[model samples]
Target: MAAPFSAVPTPFRVRAADRWWYGNCAWDAFGICAALHVDGHIETVCADCREPIVVEVRDERPDDQRLLFHCLVPAARWWADIVFT
Candidate 1:
């Protein structure tokens, strides 16, 4: 259970550096690319509709504008119950 990377399958996935990496969440997906400092493609599904979603990241910035990241729990409390967060 890596922080930005997951040991098991998850909705968030990143394809970068010629390998596939599973991410724990949306933020982590991008973090994987940022940490590697390489362009990446992210694949996931919309939570509400289950529709496929893809995002591209270059130079640590996401290319898509139709994306949003929201967290109900504040960043300070994320680690308290990370499994639920």
Candidate 2:
């Protein structure tokens, strides 16, 4: 008799372009931080900032892929809006 089936694993992996997009988003966020510092929007910037202030807590966890992408996207958009608009 054939063996019983188990839960199937995903056959495919994420594409290179997706990975690149995430990394690019992160870089854009870092750029936004610099822009905020320059543009005298320090208070609003603090509200938008995602970098953890508590050093130990920040260091304890390994990076999360989704959260990292989220952290980058809005911040980059914020800066881009400031510069171009």
Candidate 3:
């Protein structure tokens, strides 16, 4: 697993704890902030429209709702192809 860093490019880019990081997914983006124990800012894009989206994190909680974390892969099968997930 990439943990706070993604193995490949993704829409999830994060700036937290005074550093830049990549996330495996949107959920992992927030997870990065939490793991660092500091506020964060996430820059991403809408999956459907390709529009810019920004997420603010305070106390490790997302402060915006412009984006939703939707996973097509089931939790039980994520390991089958983690990069694709």
Q: Please, what are the lDDT tens digits per residue for candidate 2 over residues 1-85?
A: 0111113222111122112111123233233333333221111112256443211112222134233323433654765664342
Q: What are the models' TM-scores? A: 0.92, 0.18, 0.79
If the candidates were sorted by their lDDT against the true structure, best first, what order would they fall in? 1, 3, 2
Question: Model 1, clash count?
Answer: 0
Q: Name model 1 segments beyond 4 Å from true.
A: none
Per-residue CA lDDT of model 1 for 1-85, tens digit only, reads 8678899999998999999999999989998998788999999999999999989898777897777799999999999998788
Clashing pairs in 3: none
Where does candidate 1 have its weakest 10-residue lDDT segment? 59-68
RMSD of each: 1.0, 19.0, 2.2
TM-score, cand. 1 vs. native: 0.92
Comparing candidate 2 with candidate 3, which one achieves the higher TM-score?
A: 3
Candidate 1 lDDT (Cα, 0 to 1) = 0.90
TM-score winner: 1
Candidate 2, residue 5: the lDDT equals: 13
